[model samples]
Target: MKDSNQEEQRPKTTFSAPVVLPALLGLGALLAFCALYPEQAGRIFPSVQAWVVRQFDWFYTVAVSIFLVFLLLLAVSRFGQIRLGPEDAVPDFTFLSWTAMLFAAGMGIGLMYFGVAEPLQHFLKPPTALGGTPAAAKEALQVTFFHWGFHAWSVYGTMGLVLAYFGFRYNLPLTMRSGLYPILRGRINGPIGHGVDAFALVGTIAGIATTLGYGALQLAAGLHLLTGWNTSTAAFRLGIIVVVVGLAGVSAVSGLDKGVRRLSELNLSLALLLLGFVVITGPTVFLLQALAENVGGYLSSLVDLSLRTFAYEPPREQGWFAGWTILYWAWWISWSPFVGMFIARISRGRTIREFIIGVLLVPTAFNLLWMTAFGNGAIWMDSHVANGALAQTASNVDALLFRFFEYLPATRAASWLAVVLIAIFFVTSADSGAFVVDAIGSRGHPRSPVWQRLFWAMVLGLTAMVLLLSGGLKALQALTLVAALPVTLILLMLCYGLWRGLLADQAHSTQDLAPATSFWSGQHWRRRLEQIVHDSTREDVFRFMQATVLPAMHQVSDELRRRGVLADVQHDLDEGATVRLTIPDPELRDFIYGVRIAHRHLPVFTVQDASEDGRAQVFEPTTFFEDGRQGYDIQYLRMEEVIADILRQYERYRSLSANLRTHLLSRAPGHSEPMS
Candidate 1:
């Protein structure tokens, strides 16, 4: 048996040079330029941002609206029945963990930075209504909800659905290129794929760096508020980045299951605690009434708000629309790849309906309540208690949240808690962003060294620092808005590819005749009973693979070659018990019939004590297929039965290939290969 410690350290994959090299070169070049020429970057970035808004603000608004509508349509369609992975595959993470992680990765920092700043800004300087009026406050919360609500999550949901569908269902690498498989076909394996992934990598870094910039500023401001130590300087912000990124590097090295998950749950808990504290201490009855009114107002105005560009309005209104709404849209788009990839990484095995609904509703619901509590409570305090004091310093957006906490009970503790939450949110965003960037650079290979994650985490921190040094928060937001344009185009193509892929998936399901191996139920009943009772050892499975599985595969391979069909069987070099037979098809997915020894931990009732190596384990020689269908143990099957099974799977593969409707499935590129 292998030591658990050694297994944890074992590397399963390596970087894809085609993706990694260019991405790093590009990132390094940008950072070097920004550090060297701060003035140029400051002017250039905002110019580019203004250009995007002037040229494509309508495009951003329209595309995001479509993404939301697309997801809703999919949820109500037959395609919603399709699972991300194989039909029988169960989710890797539980519902709570999944929600917490997605929430943390998607909007934790943004919410913290904008929760008090946004609503208060809109309230004080009303877009259309007069400032400091009842109508202005209502419109303020409504617009805040609109910006942070369904539209934001839909951008994420669209990217995530594409990745999960192609990556899990079609057995492609979980990278940006995979989402374009149907359109690009095998070209996804070439330079096109490399370029797509490189773009995604750069955009993810910019997005996360932008977010980290927000967190760093807010954290610095909170500390300054708490201790009055002149923490508002660039030096302090850089120090904050270094320390938080260092912590994030540590979390990234600890791996996702251990570090990101735990931190995300902690973030959610602290956020909720702070939220509850505010509601209890603030104008509780008024806040509750505002929550209901805010949700209703948002829902009622959602349609108009989704497509409203204010094109007919004056220049001031147009600028406001661009700076606030357009910028928010672009920020969400640029951040989609990072958040979307993270969500997809955790969302395998869920149905389309479940995935869309969960991704859309869960976070949006929380955001609405949060905006209402913070935004409404702030407005209420401004009117009733502070006499416009909170509104007075809303211009210093970073310190606004802490300022709002001052009028409440336990102001010091609440302020401290908010600071801690921002710090943790910073760490989670950095760590999760590191994981996503690494995945893209590695071409979505499942495993790489911990140092790679640390590398990306450092890259994130450095980028944020450079952006801040170059032009402060404006530079950060500008880069995000600018980076999102190209990514938006890519995501639109992703939508098309996803729709085609889902259609193919539905067609493939329709062509399923029956469970492929259901014909052999009790033909070897006695042998099956023996196999069931016997807890097979690794050596036992190896012997079975060598004696029974190998001969059967060779028999089929020889016959296929006799008929001039390409067939090859290869044994896994690392594991003698694992073997795979491949019959290559040039125009469609290859037919793969593989048998591998799967190690499973024993049930509690079956094991009283584990061996020194760790938990008690059992092994099974399970069959696998190229379509990612759930495999079953074939230990009881005789040599003839194994041969029969191989031929049966090959027939199904050929049959699926012949169906015209499975076009996208036939066009997807092969899985990621080992780096040489």
Candidate 2:
């Protein structure tokens, strides 16, 4: 068996240069064009943004609404029981750690930027309620919640779920193309696959660039507030980008565990500290009331908010749909690749249900709370405390959070804390973005060259600076919105691919893998029971896997090969022993039965001798398979029983493989690869 070091040091195969090179060149060329001719870009950006919004606004609304419904259906369906990886796999991070990382995804930056600004903006120009009054306050919360709520998460959840399922369950590379494997199969390794991956990478870069732009501006705002610095200059904001991006480069080099994870935890703690202070210093009871009211209003109007297009409204009100609501949808869609794949990477062992619930609900609840506390604090200060100072400078959205803190006690300290939070969140965002972009450019290997990661970090910093100079908020919003348009169809196709892949996998795993009882029954059970009740030991388990379990698997492999199927047994001391049967398919789930020995700790109560039971550890020979079912303990089973188990699994695999080969429906020419 190869040691852990060998696996860790294993060189990855070649990345698709065709995919990586072209994507970077195209995106970089456009960014360069914008940088060189800001005048032309300024004119073209609005026109393109307005046209796409006018034409595809309905598509965004319907696509997002469908994604929410799709998630609900999938979560409750039979597929919910499916594991992201093999059934024996366990979650990499604890629930708390996972939830913290989810929150620290720099969404706090958005909340910090918009939590107050958006609500106040909506309240000033009443979307539905009376302007600057009680009804408008409630309406403001509802609108803001809609922007940050389920729709946004649904976009993210769909992408993450699809990527995780395909990557883990199928042993495919963890890239966006893997999500299309149901339709594309091996074609996912071809040019078309490269195109898909390239498109996702480009969108991710643009989204991160936009995030860096906003984060830098907010950081600058806090600095100006605390120190009375001249951050009104664009050079200062550009400097902030350079410093954060360099810090991000260092973190990216340190990798996810050492850098990103630690930083995310820190950011979460700081964010909670700030949130707690806001809740206490501000009107705590009123914030609570607003939270409840905000959620209620959102729930009641969700259907309308979901489906509303402002169709038939005047051109004036309709513009809000194109700008605020539609803009948010595009940003979330663009964000899906970076955030979705990042979430999927950390979520290897979770079930489909757990993943969907965590992705769709946990961060969203945090967002609503964060927004209510912060946004409502701003509104309350405007009406009853600070005398409309926020609205007077609403156009400078970046400074609103700093100005709001000024109304509270210890203004400078609060502003400085907010600045640090944004800066760390900025670094974490860039670190993760570079990591994800590396994965895309390297065909799902995040451990690409250190120079490659730093390269992308530089690109992000430069992109942010150039775009900020070219058009500021208009450029950021415009690029993200335009970038998301072409990618939307890809996201939709991924959903369909996920749907088909699930059905295909369900058929595969459900094939009749019933055990044969003749040889392993009666006398065999007695011998198995004798072994089962004994005090467990490592030597005993290893001996069982080698002498009994492996031989039984070999027997099955021989019989399968004799029957014309591809079957072989491979064993190693560290990698364990396994018999893998491969049954190929053209367009659907491939048939595979890889049964191997895995270890689990003995239950403390199951230990026989008190001395050894309390102290000495025992290992069990547990079986695992490709279908990701909870494997059985086979250490005590006879050779005949092991053979029966292998046969049973193969029966299920072949049954599904045959059906998928014969029955998978084809899509239109452009929708899927040519039907095999």
Candidate 3:
């Protein structure tokens, strides 16, 4: 009886209904909606997708703005004294695992498809403003790296840094709430939190929607390339779905440590082997020269390439930019949140600076190498091969990969290897994506029940099936960027929140100082505080409260002297009777209250009293009593009431200015600070 009673008292560890019910219902609704109104649903999906595309472009603007802000803060912190967190202690995975996972997760299927096609497309219709002749093969390699290099990695790296900081340092949950925790910590349980979470959820759904659509297209393309099958039929879609779901189900069951990691390793090895084959068998001199010259060109053009907006400026080159550069950017931006969160989870214990450099620079370098090796081989063949056989037959990218093998000595064996590599690559991408979706749904922890992951994996596969059934691979490709659009706004919000969090952290560290220290002798503390304030705002009292308070005392003394009053007013003022004024700033009051609230729910600091002039003041004892009671109380409750009332009014105003409010609320700590 006692055992039964104890068991009843124990907390239930079952999955929450909030997490489960919505997912199940969402899946059912999607399936049913598609079934009930197939044509309408298809059109609606794309129509909604158009909104997503616009959002994606908006996100690019936001990302660029945030990136600049981040760099500025970094510069300020260098000059001022600001530190956000203690040194990270997470172990860095060795190069093999890191590269394998990074390559598989970051590029995967996209790389395989675009390796040959992108360069060729550029060769055929080069950007007109760049003054390259049509079929000018020299620019092929340069264009390839331009497309695959730093900008794509920059988006991924930025997202990853946010995820790592929140997950490892803050002891927060792994959902969208945790991702935005730097900005929305206490508000996570509120409507604001719910909206953020929903946005993240939608982003995940959208990414999967795009991926599923593309995966179906690629599967059909691969079949058509290798087996000469007319894969444009409805049956092809069902077959692809079955294969994807079966593979994903197996991988989902195997879990990340075994299935995903092993698959990544295999994919990486296959990719390396393909590169080696090209380097050895293809025109070696031409390939190496192209790589060296293109790399140099890419390095020189990096800044321009990174900032190119492709805004339909030159009417002649508009199609080229829109079809290639803009589309790719949108695709990458859409994938950023998921990829970033996953990278962040894996990147704990690294510094913010290190995380950014590694995620942006290193992976981009690798991508450049990958593209140069594969893209150069195709360019070489197109330029110098016997009869333009490679270019003519290579109608699609998948054919290009295998056709390179046809030039090899062991054609059949090489073709088999290519097939195996393709399968592994798809599995790696699909599984990694599944894990990411699970993480987003579970909110970043590894503790989400296995069934939840499996359910999502199935849903993703089904989405792919629907896309394939509607049209062939071309149809899927057309819709990929469209689905990724809405999530772009979510990413912008994330960036804002991340920046704000970093700034806040810097401020907190700077302002916290012992009371006994003099400003000159406390230069280290002063510098740190100054750095924090400079990083976000000079008026950031949160960063330099102690320093600011000390200076304010001097200002008061100088004002009194100017008024022909005695200089020793500090000694005459009644410390016990001085009142601490409270104002109508919820954020400010929250900060003040936060300082007072203890782990045990008791107030650590309190209002001491009000002055004769009706101003309120708060104080702490210079010396400790036996009971160590701080000399304060809630003497200004009426002031708090008034502040609360004003806060409500401010919220109304905020609602009217939603975009501004979002920008303000989204600013992460190091990005923005409230005025003292």
Candidate 4:
């Protein structure tokens, strides 16, 4: 009975019913309709897709252009220096791990599936240039680079920036609704916010399902070539989905640091190894020359390519335009919430400039190189080695990569290697996608249970399987594109919200006169040195919080109450004891000054604590504010000094509240206390 009571007392995973129920119901209805009426879906989806392309091709073109330009300009602007989290916060993951995870999540499967196919298709049938000519070859690579380059990353970078900026800086839930806080204020906690997250949740599932469907097809094709098995059957793909999704479920259970991180690193290592083999064995010099030429041609033609809708061309080029460029734009936009949110999750503590530049450049550089190695290598191999035989397999999109491998050194081994790489990419995509989906579904609660993540992984696999079985994957892809229209509008609004938030951030920063705990004078030098030198334990800090912090807070609360203000002193005993003084205000942010016990690892040069684990650490009483700013140690200050520090922070808050330009910021919903 006691054990049962303890089990019941454990915290349960909280799901935002507003977000989760609608997303699940909507996805269930869509998949059921597709399963029940596959034939109707088959006919209807294509018409809907074509109609959307014919009508909004220009909107997609222009919207993507705006995203790219906006990101570049923001990176160069003064607001670039703003950190995603507290100013003093450091990055959670190292540069290499962060880059690898993001790259794998962003475009891993697509690169494997399209690297060899896109270039060859364009080379054989150039949209405007004549086929089977040098011009077509250049145009082929140029177009490939354009599609996979800065524009795609910018779409991802924009969403990531919005989520990271609002979620971390404002101490808001890390969900889509947080980005709209400046415009909606507290209404983000209402039905409207739920709707946005629900929309994103449903769209992310479809987008990831589409990518996984493609990955499953390619994996089956690769297995067929290597094992000589009849992998073309629907049962084979179903098996592939089960196996990959099961692996993804395991990864999700292991969480980001263990499973996803290791798999991403391995995925990148294997990809580079394959790329190196091709570079060494294939037409090395020609491919290198083509890569350089491709970059030049892509950059020179970027503006025209960005805006070109093929409006003046005949129906053929227009159709190609709608099929290729427009399709890619829609696909990237639809996938942004998943990729963007994942990026944001891993990108706290980075400055806006660093985040944008890294997101825009790193993965893009690798993608350009990957496409060059596979795309240009295939094109060169077709003309020289295969005598144009490789070109014949272009129509078999799933098997094209394996067919390209057939013309390379150690064809069997390389084919299997590519298969393995694709499978891992499949797992990573599902793993990360499940994580992002669960986050959206839970409205970005940070402590969801492992079972919830596994549930999402299962859902993703089943959705892909159902669609694949019913031949509705294409229809779902089309629906995702239509969904991108509304997402684009939301993204534009997010841009506005982010801009306003940043302006307020800069204004708040400009008002900082001194550190809150910097009032120690030379007369208190002995006390300051004693506090810094002593390796205080948790007990010591708790004593300081009780003796020094609580008294100061109560004094302030007493004075405010006596002045007819509703001020209160609150004490919390959980997760490191805290004492806070709060002054309530309905029109603006409530003024909060808090002191909590914080622990840190002892520096290498410091005296060891000699704990049971042989690890050295120290604890200090630190000051925190209502806004998610970094705190400082206040253990060295006297109680009177602590009161003065609180008043200084309160003055700054009052000044910010009075600024007309920062009205949205002051009135925006703020945290009751700083986030851990």
> Model 3, residue 23: displacement in angstroms?
5.6
lDDT of 1: 0.88
Best by lDDT: 4
lDDT over C-alpha atoms for residue 128 of model 1? 87
Over the full model, what C-alpha lDDT does candidate 3 score relative to the true structure? 0.58
Candidate 1 regions exceeding 4 Å error are 1-9, 512-676
lDDT of 1 by residue, 1-676 (tens): 5757766876855789988889889877877777777778778989989998999999999999999999999999999989999999899888999999988999888888888889999998877888999999999999899999999999999999999999999999999899999888899999999998998888788778877887887898899889999987889989999999999999997889989999999999999999899899999999999998999989998999999999899988888898789988998898888889999999999999999999999999999988888999899999999999998899998899999999899999999999999999999999999999999988888867778888889889988988788764566467767889999999999999998888878787887533324656667677767877989998888888888999999999999999999999999736356799998876677889999998898865323455345776898888898888988887776788789989988888878776767655754486432233
> Candidate 2 lDDT, tens digit per residue, 1-676?
5766765675654456977788889888878777787777778887888899899999999999999999988899999999999989999888987887777773767877887799888888756566899888888889899999988989988988988898889888889999988777789999989888888887788888878888887888788777889997988989999999999999987878778888888988998899999999899999999899899889999999999998888877788778899989988888889988888888999999999899889988989999899888899998888788787987789888888888888788778888888899899899989888888888887446577888889988888888888764466468768888877888899999999999989988896533333345467566656775786676777777777777876787788679886666767756545545454455545455554555555545432654473555656666665545676555656777777776777777656545635344322123344455
Where does model 2 exceed 4 Å of error? 1-15, 469-473, 514-676
User: How many residue pairs collide in each prediction?
Assistant: 0, 2, 32, 0
TM accuracy, model 2: 0.75
lDDT of 2: 0.81
TM-score of each: 0.75, 0.75, 0.69, 0.76
lDDT of 3 by residue, 102-180 (tens): 8788887777777777776666667752422424555666767866776677667656765666666566665666666
